[model samples]
Target: MIDLFKFFGKEESKSKDIAKERLKLVLIHDRANISPKFLDMIKDDIIKVISNYMEIEEAGLDIRLSRIPQEDDTYSTALVANIPIRRVKNMGPNRG
Candidate 1:
């Protein structure tokens, strides 16, 4: 039997990777002059707006700010969100 954990890297390694990613995000936020509380507020607002239309897996949601390369070789900050939607809400005839 194959060791699935080995095939997909060990849990310890995965945790380390997660830590590295979190650290990177923290640094990016600092450079962008954005606070964690502000980011959390934005995330909460996003969830509220999105939840009005569809069911979402809040636990699996991921949102971050990243730098995107531009045509002029300049980098612009962007808000990236990965929201896992479960299903769309059924809107009745009276619903807009």
Candidate 2:
């Protein structure tokens, strides 16, 4: 027999996860004060810059704008980039 409670619980969990992700996107967009296209460009540039020194898990990379509370009761936008490093790259002496 199929367990209705378990099935509903799993569905509810999935819905909650989706809702949370949507809310995060909305918050980031509102707080960043930047267009989505610009954000994508920034994200790509960040990935490229980091990739020069180390290999990063592109799929695991999370770049978002967050609101940080300040002592003056004001909020500031911060760029948070969570780059998962797969391995460090070895860069030899630069011959310029």
Candidate 3:
């Protein structure tokens, strides 16, 4: 049972979590002014391009674009993606 006496623990609270989460999100949004809808569009474009040339495992794909808070608490957003593809099976003239 949670101790009511320790209600004000030194741990992060739900409100704090919301603030931090919103802060990071707002920072990213404000820096680029890119809507979530636009982000989805970009993701689709990236997936299309990468899919055309390789049999990549979609679950392994990682794509993130965000800004880092600098000294002035202002920063630029950066796009980062990781697409891993396994080696092709066989294409040695069928060993003929």
Q: Pick the candidate with the highest TM-score.
A: 1
Among residues 3 or more apart in sequence or in different chains, the pairs in candidate 2 whose N, CA or C atoms overlap within 3 Å are: none
* Candidate 1 colliding pairs: none
Count of clashing residue pairs in every prediction: 0, 0, 0
CA error at residue 93 for candidate 2, angstroms: 3.9
How accurate locally is residue 90 in candidate 3, as Cα lDDT from 0 to 100? 50
* Candidate 3 C-alpha lDDT tens digits along 20-95: 9778877786678878788778888998876765667778887667776689886768877887886443536755
TM for candidate 2 is 0.72
Off by over 4 Å in 2: 1-21, 94-96
Give stretches of model 1 more than 4 Å off: 1-20
Greater lDDT among 1 and 3 belongs to 1
Instruction: Summarize candidate 1's per-residue lDDT along 24-57 as a digit string, tens digits.
Output: 8887898899998999999999999999999999
With a 3 Å backbone cut-off (N, CA, C), the pairs that clash in candidate 3 are none
Q: Candidate 3, 75: how far from true, in Å?
A: 2.5
Q: Note each model's CA RMSD in angstroms.
A: 4.2, 2.9, 5.4
lDDT of 2 by residue, 1-96 (tens): 999999999999999999998887777787666877888999999998888889999999998877788999988888888999999887878821
